[model samples]
Target: MTGRITFWFDFASTYSYLSVMRIGGLAAARGISVSWKPFLLGPVFAAQGWNTSPFNLFPAKGRYMWRDLERICAARGLSFCRPDSFPQNGLLAARLALAAAEEDRIAAFTQAVFQAQFGQGADIADERVLQGCLRVSGLAPGLVQRALDPAIKSALRAQTDEAIAMGIFGAPSFTSGAELFWGDDRLEQALDHAAAVTI
Candidate 1:
């Protein structure tokens, strides 16, 4: 059996930005098929009695995260620009990613969205910005309308629920069968586990 990894991410997550940008190349090199799963972190945080990103709730952690992200991006040769908003509204983006999945363009669309938000410091909540991301991903800008479909909205909600059920509390998580790995730094370890188990 071919190795597989389920990638769980939230659009507003800074660390997810790193994994979304790098996973494609890494997975391909390892012959691992990636299942990109987009879900909301808001509900997950709410369940934990938090209303905002931990980075915001803890100022020192937020400061360290930004610097760490800068160093990692530099080392990886990836662009990194801290968004003006700590956690940009990603509800719309997550819905649109589900829409993209129907056409097998989710990965491209995801990378575009992350790049626009973290690379160019764009506001992902803006429809215009999302439309531009669609174009970058070689998808029609009209996908924005599809993202508004009731089915898509429900699907995103369900996906978030599933993430929580799977014990995922953060973005950039990976799952190989029953084994779950969290954080961007753990990506390689997750991939290695998947390759070893072929799950």
Candidate 2:
């Protein structure tokens, strides 16, 4: 049996950027099928009585995270640049990613967005940036308009609700059947669990 896992991420999550860039190759190597699920963290954070990213709510952790991210990106040979904004609004990006999923271009589109934001420090909330990402992913920039469809908006909302129900309090989460793993560092453990549980 082939392993299968669902990757839950928010476009604004710094750790999620790491997993997004690396999950493709890792999953392919282990012959694990991946489902890229884009969700918003705002609601989840609110549920926990927080008004913003924990990185912002806690300054010390935020400082450590940025430096840690820098070191990790350097080690992996991936570009790293802190965006002017800690958490750029990702509502538009998430919707577009769902649109890309329909055409089976989610992986490419997602990587492009992450690179644009974390690698080049672009503002993902900007439609122009999103359109550029779409183009580079070999998708039509017009999808930006399509992403505004009511159906797309509702889908994103529903996805976020689902994430909450799954007990996913953070981005870069993975689920293998009923097992849940959080954080980029747990990625391999999640994949291994999926593979081992395959029947």
Candidate 3:
């Protein structure tokens, strides 16, 4: 039986960067279909009475998160530049990715966006930056404009609303039925659980 893995990722999330880089091969080996569902965690946090990443809400943990990211990226041979802007606006990027999926190029788009944000320190909110990402995926810039259309915006809004309803409060959340898993650390377990449940 094939299992569906709903991946709730936030582009600004560091841990999510690691998962995106790693999950593909892991899921393939397990014969799982990884559904990439990108969404913003900020709006969810706002509703939860929090203003920022918990790492940011706490000074020491925030500091440690930075240093830890540097070490992890180094170990994985990945770039670790913390963008001057924390939690770069990812709403538009996510919308564009969903738009790319409609064109059958979501994998390329996802890789490019992840590399642009986590690897190259590119500004995700900038139209030029997004266009560059789309170009890297061999996609036309026009689709991004389409993603901003009323129809797509409504879809994106609905996705966010559904995520909130699913008890998702953070990026890197995963779900199999009503089984909710939050955080990048839980990604593998979620995948395994979904696969096992399907079996």
Candidate 4:
């Protein structure tokens, strides 16, 4: 049976990076159509009285998370680097993603940004880095100008608002109907739930 899933992610989330890289192939194998929804975690965290990532807020947690990420990346044969900044500003990237999603280039753009940030330890907030990502993704560089459009900015805000309305509080969340699954570990479970449902 065919199924549908909405993937909600934040550009700066480490675990989200893992899901972004693998979800596409895994979902395709299960006849599940995936929707890439990029949203900001700033507002969500603020709402919960967090000024930063829980990993950053709690040193013990932060240490554990980095080690966990290292293990996960090694096992998956993916590059891993701890960014100088824990959560880089993703405003520009989110706007660009919305534009890329429209042109059916979300996968390429998303992976490029993730790789740039996590794989190369580059700052994603830099316009030049983003431009490079656009180039590597086979998307026209002019899309960067489009990302500056007011409407695109508004669309990103709307997406974040929608995510909040859907009760999302974290990244790499999967929604199958009203069921919500959080984290990379839950990806397959979410897909299975989607597949089992007759939507």
The lDDT of each candidate is 0.94, 0.96, 0.83, 0.93
Q: Which ten residues in a row have the lowest lDDT in candidate 1?
A: 190-199
Q: How many residue pairs clash in each candidate?
A: 0, 0, 0, 0
Cα lDDT tens digits for candidate 4, 54-164: 988999988998899889999999999888998899989999999998899998899999999998899999999999999998899899889999999998889889999
Candidate 4 has which clashing residue pairs, if any?
Answer: none
Ranking by TM-score: 2, 1, 4, 3
Best by lDDT: 2
In model 3, which runs have C-alpha deviations exceeding 4 angstroms?
Answer: none
The Cα RMSD in angstroms, rounded to one decimal, for candidate 4 relative to the true structure is 1.0
Tens digits of per-residue lDDT, candidate 2, 155-196, equal 999999999999999999999999999999999999999889
Weakest lDDT window of 10 consecutive positions for candidate 2: 190-199
In the predicted model 2, the residue pairs found to clash are none
lDDT pick, better of 1 and 3: 1
**Residue 150: error of model 2 in Å?**
1.2
Off by over 4 Å in 1: none
Error of 2 at 137 (Å): 0.5
Clashing pairs in 1: none
